[model samples]
Target: VLRDERCTNLSSLIFATIFFGNLAFRAYYSRKM
Candidate 1:
């Protein structure tokens, strides 16, 4: 159960990182344009 929770947390963290990264990249590109 603990291992499962850890995996879930890691997945969520990765998802959030990707989400934010995409947003940042979009903003950067928009600024450049």
Candidate 2:
């Protein structure tokens, strides 16, 4: 579907996924330590 287009939604989704993942990871590590 996004084969020929610059998909901002896709990038945004990826960024959000990574951002939340990092946030959760940090929280987990901080809680552990």
- What is candidate 1's lDDT per residue for 1-33, written digit by digit as tens? 999999999999999999999999999999999
Tell me which residue pairs clash in candidate 1. Answer: none
Where does candidate 2 stray beyond 4 Å? 1-6
The sequence of per-residue lDDT tens digits that candidate 2 reaches over residues 1-33 is 575345877788899999999999999999999
- Segments of candidate 1 deviating more than 4 angstroms: none
Residue 30 in candidate 1, Cα distance off native in Å? 0.2
What RMSD does each model have against the real structure?
0.4, 2.8
Score residue 20 of candidate 1 by CA lDDT: 100
- lDDT for each of the candidates? 1.00, 0.88
